[model samples]
Target chain A: METIKNLLMGFSVLLTPENMLYSFGGVLIGQIVGILPGLGSVIAIAVLLPFTYSLDPIPALVAFCGIYYGSQFGGAISSILINAPGTESAVMTTVDGYPMAKKGQAGRALGTAAISSFTGGMAGSILVVLLAGPLVQMIISFAAPEYLALMIFAMACITGMAEKSSQAKSIVAICTGLALGTIGLDVSFGAPRMTFGSLALYEGISFIILAIGVFAMAEVMRNVSNAKHNGLQRIHAMEVVGRVGISLKDWKLIIPTHIRCTLVGFFIGVLPGVGAATATPLCYSLEKKIIGEDNAEWGKGEIRGVAAPESANNSCAMGALMPLLTLGVPGSSSAAIMLTAFMILGIQPGPLLFQNHPDILWALLASFFIGNVMLLVINLPLVRYCVKLVQVPTELLFMSVWILAIVGSYAVGLRVFDVGMICILSVLGVVYGICKIPLAPMLVAILLGDMIEYYLAATIVLCRRSFVNFMSRPIVLLFLVLAVLVIVLPMLRDRFKKNKVQSAVDIIDAPE
Target chain B: MKSRQDLLFEIKVSVFLLVFALVYVILTLVGIDTSGRFLQGNAGLDPTTFPYFIGIVFTGTAFYLLVKSIYQYRLNTEKENTDAAKGIGIPVVEKKPFPFPVKASLVPYIAFIVYIATLRLFGFILDSVLLSIVILFYLNQKNRMRNIIFAIVFPVFVFLLFNKVLDVRLPIGYIFGAKY
Candidate 1:
């Protein structure tokens, strides 16, 4: 009854015209940004963050949340129409989505994607309302040691889940990010550590600059390089969207996949440090295995293939808000940026959040449902026009991204030094991109590294200078064990697989 | 099978990381301002302790990576030699250059830097317009009038959106006045 009343109150607050308009605008911009390759929600939110500073907290939160979910809807458009994933989470969509487009079922591919995204997002928002309250109460009992252990578990999971990169490389990237985080003034002691006598480095490298440099700018360099090599092949959208929408038969096939993937993605999101990137691949591989058919058309135009990953990633986006709002731990890179907004708005999201700001919290939760509906309405009808974005010349797109990145970086600090750093970081990003190094771990590390240090320091102080005392805490011990398993399980699994393959080859070679 | 180029790149990255870790370790040891004895009594909460530990761990990981890369390189080379002896050669794949002219693609990045460098002198409107025009020319967008219109219009749009609507302050161009 209490939860129902609170939810009703939240709905009343969110139904206001001003809040709805902001949500509309946010989703609109998010869709546009997500349609453009190299301009993900992380950079979009960062660019629009300053604009939210002067607005009322409720409307601002509503808009930002809209952008977060709306971008997921927009991401599917490019992935299906052009094979370019506007966000990392959308990467898996292109595998099956592009194949669907090639088969002239672009509308079906896009329609299913839209429907699945909405279902996943709605599921996530519902989970947030149900799970976040209890989770916050549970986490409030945690001490510094538990927090330290949780962070370690997060790092381990992320490193293990990294795509297309060796674990060693991922570790190197994360450690390097942590090292960079230590560059500015030491928070514990006001003395600067790695500034190297430069006053500009005193405040530390801005997260916004780093995000733009590696994610946005690096993407531009790669695209330019790709266009230079591939001669800029044009992406032509299908003239007809076959059937224009999903039929009942298609819905029956996808409903189960959506529920399963959403559950998987939501759980992963609740874990700090993991996000949609991890969840999407997990769902993709799981869906493949469960198909149980030798002739299963995965990586082809299988609707379930597109449906699974799209739903998972969208759910993952919603799931991420769980930790961010309740535990003050950002579940993904985009959420990390959102944490900055929460701080800027003088709202620290943790145990006290619900008690002190129940109205804000419930309203934010209610806005998620509104935002998801808005995204569906905007995306389903406009996908055809959105697909036309692929037809825009590659050169024009590159130039626009470059201009946005430069201005976005400048708007953060309004200093030439920030631009200089962007240039340097852009070059670095290009190098990293060329090397095929994973940047997600590094981005996560930068966001969590300081918190790790702070927690470690606090735990140490509480332990009276004896680190061994942490071993006595059961929760900490359990998490430490989980972290170790996360690291070692993949190695064991790989060795097991290799042995199995070798034995099969031996049998074939000897008997044949 | 791993290519020779991939192996070499791995080795190079490992070596670079090892050297970087070493530098980090040295700096943490010497540069941290402890204000007195590095370890006075309770070493747990010391500011330098965490960084020092990280530096050490980084060094160890980098060394491990270096050794692993070297081992993998040798294994790849040996496999290649064995394949040659068996009269089976791996197909040589040539490295492809960037599709667009490298210099052409770099033009926008260079223009962006120039715009930022000259922002104070030219102001936001002039600098943004000039930057947009330069980029449009590089991209080979043939409509000169359209380019000119966009170059002027985009900056004004941003100015009004940021300045008038959002109230976020933007550069007014030093040459236009003294207002920032």
Candidate 2:
């Protein structure tokens, strides 16, 4: 009843002519950003940030939220066609989606991705509108000690998601981030801890600089050392493609995977510090479980493979915003950036968001539903045509990306320093490509590292450094228990799997 | 054999960082004067306390890493007695590292860095022109005329977009500075 009334109120706010147009425009631009590789929502959002300063807070916020998710829908297009993930979350989508494209089922893969993304986005929005209230209350109930337990869950999730052989490397990268976070000045004590007496280092590193460097630039550099996947030319992407509807059998196979992935993505997205970059891989792995060993078409354009990852990640990506909208604690990296945007407008996002600012919140929540519907309506028909956008040649492609990055960063502060940083980071990104290390962990780490550490130190301060609060709390204990189970359960399952197979074979032999 | 090289490189970097952290710890312990004016916090509890605590943890982790890397190196070297990389089971395809369409990508990375460094000298317009041309060259197509067209058009477009419309100043280099 509460959700229904609120959603209805939200719909009323969205129906306004100006707000409706902005949402449509936001997603329309978002698709182009998605269709283009190396330029994702981060850069697109970064670019779009300055223009919205003139608008009222609600319309601006709604437009941005639309762009954020719309870009996600767009990312699936690139991955499905060229195997190039438009968004980090869409990276996993490419693993299966591109193969489908190669198989000339480009239409089917595109349709499936678009449909599943729409459903997943709806599911995630519903979670935001309804479930977020209770979730925040639950998250806030944990005392400092319990927070320590939760932070441990966050860390384990990171480790669980890390590429093996580089597991230690990921932790090292995180530790480095935690260290970098302390450089400007200690928050508690104003004394500069790591500034080394540099004038520029006093404020420490700018989040914009870090975001541009780690996410945008580093990724660019990493891409350079590799082979130019001329795979784009190979996928002719005829207009006739994307028309093949989902095969009935494929639908049956994928429906379960979609639900599972959406759940996985939504829940993971809801976790602070866990991001689409992490959630997509987790969903892909989860999809492997439902697949039959012999009949499963994994790694070769399986519908389940495409559906499970995209649906889950897109859902999860939206899930990251709930905490931001509800509690003011950012649920994801992008949400943190958006939170800053809200703060700049002097409209802090917190528990107060629901009650005091009903108009804005209503429009925002409505935009989620309306925007998602808009995205489906906007993206589906365009899927057939948008595939041709990638045919834009390489030199033109990268030049446009450079031009856009510069334009976006400069718009943020109009500071030449920002453009300078953008160019520097873009170059650095290419070099990082030469190194085998993935950039996602570094970007996510940079975003969450300081916040996690700040909260951690504050928790220690508040708890009198006591261990009892963590042990006493229900959620904290539950998280700890789950953390333990995740690490232990896999080994146990492997053992059980081996033993059961052995027994089944032995029984058959005995009858023989 | 190539995998052996990769393992060695990782081992080397890990060892180097571990050593760096250990040295930092030893120096800090022996009165390295880390408690500078900046580290001093009023009301007894200082910022130095956090730095020292984190430094100690970092030192310990680095030492543990050093030990782990050494152990891994020795174990891998012995187990691979005949020199096969511990195949994380990724079947290494015999494909050469850049088969034609691949090698062209490497140039842009260098050009990207070069453009950044030369930004002030060349101005945003000229630097962009150079960068786009370099990229076109990297793609290695016939028709210098097309490259010239892109080389000219790309920079002008970006200039009009960012500098003119957005009012974000792009460096015009020394030549434009004198003229203006």
Candidate 3:
């Protein structure tokens, strides 16, 4: 009853004309950003962070939430029409989505994707409301030791689970972030650590600057280079013929896939380090495995294939927010930027956020529900127009991105130094990309570094510097054990896989 | 071996990381002040403690990476030799080089630095517009008119949206002597 009342209050807060307009604007921009290849919600949000400084928390947050899931809706459009995913999370959508487009079922593919995304978002929002309260309640009593352990666990998971990067590189990235995080005046000592006498370094590198540099500017650099080499591939979007609405029969086929994927995606999203990119592929594979290759086309315009990933992607995005809102731990890169937004808005998200700022929490949740509906309304009727976003020239698009990144970074503190830092970090980002080093762990570490240090400091004070006393706390010990397991298990699994491959190769050589 | 270039890249990255970690540790030790003590006195952790810990761990991990990469490179070399001696055919995969050479990639960075340095003199709108045009032209030299138009219009739009509407004060050019 209280939850329902709170949700109503949230809806009331969000229903204002101004808030609604901001939400609409955010969604619209997100849709455009999504349609443009090489742009994602992370860059959009990071670039927009400086602008949000002037607005009230609620309107700013509402706009951000709209952009968050709005991109998911936009991503599927490109995936279906141009066979290019607007975001990494939308990659799986191209497999069946493009095939459907090729078969002149582009409308059907897009329709399924939009509806599934809406359903998944709505379902995920409901789950967030239900799950957030319980999760907060459980973690509200945690002390410094447990919080420290939890952060370690999160970092460990990110380092362990990062795709296509070696663990050593991930560790280096995380440490670099931690090192960067320590540049400012210490929270405890009030002494500057590594400012090197620059006042600009006193507050440390702004998260907004780092985010734009790494995510947006670095990406623009890569895209520009690629365009220079290969030239921008002119988009030939498939025609969206016929009605864009999914039929009742199509709905019947999609409903089950939606339910299963939402659940799968939500759970995966709740886990730190795993995100929609992981969830979408998993859901796609799960759908393929369940439907079986013989029964379904799998890759060739299967509606379930379209449904599974789209459903999972949006739900996973919502699921990533669960930890952010409840535990103050970001579950993904997008969530990390949102966490930064919350801080910029002077709102701290965590267990006490419900007690202290229930209005903000519930209103944000309500916006998700509202945003999903708005996305569906905008997506269904305007998809044909939206597909034209693919026709945007890559050179022009990237140039605008570079301008936005520069202006946004400069706007953060009105400092040319910040703008210069963007270039430096962008160069580093390019290096990291070239080396195949995962950036997520570094980002997460940077965001969490201060908090991790605070908790560690508090823990030291609480335990009187006794390691045994620190380990005596059951929750802390459990988290530490889990962290170790998270790190070790992946290593063991990789070793096993390598050994198995080597043995197979040996057998092949012996027989030959 | 096809992976020789990749191994060399990894080795270089590992060595860079190793040097970075060492420098990080040295900086933390020299730069951070630990004279002020907490409630626990000398036993209490200081601002440098976390950074030191991170630096040491980073150094260890980077060292591990360096050793691992060197071993992998040696193994790859041995495999290549074995394959060659056995007259075995190896598939040569064509790897796409990064479109921009090091020097070429540095051009955008240099342009950005110049843009920032000139922002105060030229102002946000003018500098941004000029930067946009240059970048758009660099990206594609053919679409002169379209690029020029877009370069002007978009920055003005962003300027109005940010400076006028959002109420964030963007710099006006000192050359024009325009006051907000």
Candidate 4:
């Protein structure tokens, strides 16, 4: 009854004209930004962070939420039309989405993606409403030790579960982030640790500057070198996108997959550090397994392939946002930026947030529900128009991106130093990309670093200067054990697989 | 054997990380004030403690990367030699050379640095407009009219959107004394 009342109150706050307009604007910008190659929710939110500085907290939250959800919708457009994913999460979609487009069922493929995304998003929001309150209540008992252990577990999970990168590279990336995080004023003692006498380094590096440099600028450098002069030709291929509505038969087919993907994605999302990048591929592979690898339709424009991932991606977004709202810990890169925005707005998200800022929390949740609906209504009809976004010339697109990145960096502090820093990071980002190092873990580490340090400091004080006392807490021990398992289990599995392969090869050689 | 590009990239990154870690360690040691270090009975209360821990971890990781990359090069070489001895036919994959831009890829980055460096003297609009045109020309974008329009419009659009509507401040030109 209280939940229903709270939801009703939330809807009342959300339906106000001003909040509604902000939500609409956020998703609108998100969709457009998502359709653009090389721009994702992270860049969108980061670039828009400075602009949100002056707005009311509710509207700011609404706009950011819109961008977050809207980008997921936009990412699928290019993946289907041009075989290029607009967001990293959309990478899985392109595998079967583009193939479906090639088969001239582009409309059906896009329709399935959009509808499944809506279903998944709704499931995620509903789960947040149902589960977050209870979860927060449970976690409220946690002390600094448990929280510190949780952060370590999250980092370990990220390093261990990163699908494509080597564990060594992931570890290096995380360590690099931790190192960068230690820059500027030490929170505990208020002493500068590594500022090197520069005032700009006093506040440490801005997350927006790092994001713009690594994602936007690094992407421009890569595209400028690898892209064809006539890369815009892919936009003409947009004509095949027929009509954007799923068939009744196809809807029936995806019903089970949608339910499974949403549950998996939402649960993974609730877990800190694991994100849509993990969820989507897991959903894809699970679907392939269910369909059986022998099935010819699995990868060759199978509607389920598009449906499963798109659903999981959006559901994951919802799941990721829950921790950021209910707890202060962010579950994904986008949520990390959102948490930064929350800090900028002078609002701390946690259990007390429900009591102290119930208005903001409820209204933000309400807007999320509305924003998903808005995205669906806005995206389906505009699929044809959104597809034309790919038609923008590379030169024009790159120039616009560069301008946005420069202007956005300047807008942050209105300082030239930020621009200089962004330029340097961009170069480093290019190098990291060339070396096959993952950038996300590093970004995650940087964002979570201060919290980790803060918790560690608090734990030390609480334990009376003995780190061993942390093990006395059951929850803390559990988190530490989980972290160890996360790091070790993958290596064990890999070694097992290697041994099995070697035995099979040996047997073949001996018999021959 | 490992590709030259792969080896060069790995070595460059390893060296860069090593240097970065080294600088971090040196700066933390020098810049941090240890006057209050012993005052806090809990070592975690000392600000330098976390930074030192991160620094050591960073240094260790960089060293591991350096050693592992070099080892991988030796292992690849041995594998190549073994394959050659067995007369195994190795597939020669065609390597795509890095597309060396006409003005070089460094041009845009350099242009951006110059723009920011000149922000106070030239202002955001003037510097941005000039940079856009220069970058487009450098990229060999052929549409002169579109380039001119975009060059003028994008900066003005960003300036107006941010400065006027968003109420964000921007740097004005010292040369023309334009206030923004």
**TM-score, every prediction:** 0.93, 0.80, 0.95, 0.94
Between candidates 2 and 3, the TM-score winner = 3
- The number of the candidate with the highest lDDT is 3
- lDDT by residue for model 3 over A1-512, one digit each (tens)? 77899999999988999989988888888888787778999999998887888899999999988888899889999999988899888999999999998998988998999999999999999999988888888898899999998998888887777653577788888898888888888877778888878888999898889889888989988887666666667888889999898789988999999999999999889889888988999999898888888888888899999999999999999999999999999867899999999999999999989999988888899999888888999899988988887887888888878878877897888877888999889888888887777887788888888898888888888888899999999998998898898888877898899899999999989955
The regions of model 2 sitting more than 4 angstroms off are A37-39, A46-56, A83-104, A139-149, A223-239, A242-257, A273-305, A327-352, A355-358, A407-435, A468-512, B1-3, B16-45, B49-66, B82-123, B138-180
Report the lDDT of model 4 for residue A61.
90
lDDT at position A16, candidate 4: 87
**Rank by DockQ, descending?**
3, 4, 1, 2
Q: What share of the true interface contacts does each candidate keep?
A: 0.36, 0.18, 0.67, 0.63
> TM-score (chain A) of candidate 1?
0.93
Cα lDDT tens digits for candidate 2, A218-312: 44444433324442232343343536357787677778877888888888887766788878888888778657645677889888778887788
List runs of model 4 lying over 4 Å from the truth. A163-165, A225-235, A294-296, B1-12, B35-39, B89-103, B178-180
RMSD of each: 2.7, 5.5, 2.2, 2.5
DockQ of 4: 0.55
Candidate 1 Cα errors over 4 Å, as ranges = A163-165, A224-233, A294-300, B26-31, B37-43, B96-106
Better of 1 and 3 by DockQ: 3
Residue-level lDDT of model 1, residues A430-474, one tens digit each, is 766655667777777877878898888788777776657888889
Indicate the docking level reached by candidate 3: medium
On residues B84-158, what C-alpha lDDT tens digit does candidate 4 reach at each position? Answer: 899985557567554333335567777878988998899888998999898777665567888899999998998
Better of 2 and 4 by TM-score: 4
Judged by whole-model lDDT over C-alpha atoms, candidate 3 comes out at 0.86
Count: clashes, candidate 4: 0
